[model samples]
Target chain A: MEEEAKAKPRNPSGPRLCCVCNTRRAALKRPKTLDQICRECFYEVFEEEIHQVIVENQLFSPGERIAIGASGGKGEHGLLSINLYFCSVEDSTVLAYVLSTLNRRHHYGLDLFLLSVDEGITGYRDDSLETVKRNEIQYGLPLKVVSYKDLYGWTMDEIVKMIGLKNNCTFCGVFRRQALDRGAAMLKVDKVATGHNADDIAETVLLNILRGDIARLGRCTAITTGEDGPIPRCKPFKHLFSKCISRFCSGVHQGFGKNKVVSSLTIRNCGLQKPRAILDIIKSGEDFRISTSTKMPEQGTCERCGYISSQAIDRATKVIIPGWKWCKACVLLEGLNKGLPKMGIGRSRGLNNDRKDAKGNDNAAKSIESKQCGTLDF
Target chain B: MQLTLEFGGGLELLCDSVKIHKVSVEPQNGAEMLTMKDLLTWVRTNLIKERPEMFMKGDTVRPGVLVLVNDCDWELSGQLNTTLEDKDVVVFISTLHGG
Candidate 1:
């Protein structure tokens, strides 16, 4: 296949040899002036229908900092990386890719990587830090290595083992999520992008739906820009399938990050076989589209985490709902309101009158209607 | 056979007791008559504003509330729709998110 690619005069437009299975042919190609990756690799990326993803949600605008969680895994093939850089070449230059990795002891990969043109960390996080250094020279962009232990209180190995896989998924996810944002804050980057491949997105959607996680299931779109939260994160690969992404990634040979054929996940080593891992039970909805399976629920914040999670404030805000029993944002918010009136006005707006209006009514319908500060129909 | 039902948010809004099943006492008394779905429906229709979208879809649902179907998180059984037999202990407890 290598000889074939070299032997034949590259038709500025023909499919090239695959990046992973060099035995097969790629399905796509890059333009002569754009990047140096093959077409097949292009499809394997969330880059396939990028315009649709962006336009549907109106993601990009002037002065937007697109922060990317560069896992450097099977998710971020060379084609997707370079293409993403090229797409944002002009107006959007502050591309801070958050390298969310685990304890090197866990042996996930990318040790002491140069995050920038030549920037590498001295001790812990040296490998991934070094990769970011190399990325700077390779793409001539800003790179930041985000560490998880500093912010989340545990490394992947420590967390997975202690919490025991099933529940550890949430721990790993929450830590890495916050870790990226904290890193982005350090770098002073605004928006963020992540290489969450199709498989990852689909699995999450399925899991959310299975658990009746109304909030997560609905908002897991290809491009979810966060509002009422810090640093909006957008995903361009939310809709494509894994096979296409794999097909597209296979043709990527040079220039950008590697790790194309590794497993379609970063949680491979956590040895997940637990009851809550979702991967075990949430089967892929073959021939299913995001529109068909999801019913985007209303948007609200977790009174604990303050992150853009399910926007359900009613049940979650109940007295019996427990304070620590909310989203990370909700929990934080609840804590902040501790020792003070839970609801009423607080220099911003007053709801004491509202609470009084429904007091003693206990009628679900009337209370709901009055709670809204609007007219009641039913 | 008096059972206590400690709901999440709305429990405070209701009286100390309500006649759920033939048992004219607390929710715990009619543990067999009540369910996660039933409790949710009551909350949706009488207490809260919206609805609990995915309450029971076989094994797909995670038990959000700490339902002691005999003093154990329903995660012990397939959550959400776990059925209750005779003398089954159904106690609605609290939930825990993160730190």
Candidate 2:
């Protein structure tokens, strides 16, 4: 050990002090600002930044009923859910201890509910929901679970078995968006708050650009979306970084662990530089200006379900397609019920036939001219 | 030197779901002190049973994996260059699991 010490080069700099407090030893370096801060100071700055975002954006009104979308894991996403809820409340003292005392405090005036989607992927979702259920009791929030099996009569496990893994995400993604809306509508909440952090928004911006989805690209960076829909949605964590969310989640989970309530909050990072790049993408998305002459798709209600959609409705099948005016859900259901799972999937002969007629008859065909199977809107 | 390593955020899945391991490690190539860089190699070799890529990439931990030394972020201690002491508690939490 002495010989090892001799061979090792001494660190040029000793322990540095926190940049914010200027006293305590620095614990971590902030990626956004590159500030070296201690744990206590980091907590303060992190929570304060979130509070500022909420106040500046007016994310919620005092009496509005809000539904928090939660998925059980390491609790990072759940931490965002709880943090946003707590931040909206007027108690600064309780913020630090919110996780432990959330069940007992009811003075926030806002009705908050935990909404989770069960994809019915067997072991994966089932195990995660256990953590969600535990969090429900721990936080004393009412839990509402909406499953794919109930909403669409198809579990992901069954869907994967039939569709294989190739485009399973497409089915799951489309189903989940509708399921969340249905769940929120069932709860009768005034608004829905999802834990979509900065990184997530950035990724969507990049994806929208890659797919040349100018409409979604413009709306993806907005803090609140679908305000005109039945249930308006907002992302309170839209400005917060994923790393901070993970740290906060772990901190809260550890704090509550002594009381024997395990926190199963799981977080996935998409790499370090990726988030910075994502922010740049969001900036680019914000600065984008679509030419006025661009023929944008007209927003219309799904003829069958009355949900707002931008896709053309199919006249014959009553499904949403290029020449049709039905939503993807209605079309997929029609396909499934009629034993034609491949009906709207890829570039099938049926779709080609529809396109031929669409080109001849309608101008809306241009909107979906390049649309492929599984690439339709959620 | 003897050390305690803890894994969280589904990283334990790579190691048979074992969250913690106590093991002894020595500096490689006749070095006197063990830095986090060496410790990572040791972990990849002995601890990670499969999918080593999940834990490491190009001689360092894959981005998004948080490393803490003695309850502090490894960034404070120079990351891979932070030298280890006896009985130091190191934590490896992967933030790569689905939220």
For each candidate in turn, give its C-alpha RMSD to the true structure in angstroms. 22.4, 8.5
Q: A-chain TM-score per prediction?
A: 0.47, 0.73
| Model 1 DockQ class | incorrect
Over 4 Å off, model 1:
A5-57, A71-133, A160-166, A247-250, A254-378, B1-99
Q: Residues A87-149, candidate 1, lDDT per residue (tens digit)?
A: 111111112221211112223232222211111112323433444465566544556655544
DockQ of each: 0.01, 0.38
Off by over 4 Å in 2: A1-14, A71-108, A254-276, A309-324, A347-378
Alpha carbon lDDT of each predicted model: 0.35, 0.61
Say which candidate scores most in DockQ.
2
Identify the candidate with maximal lDDT: 2
lDDT of 2 by residue, A3-56 (tens): 332233233565577899998767677877778887789877776676667668
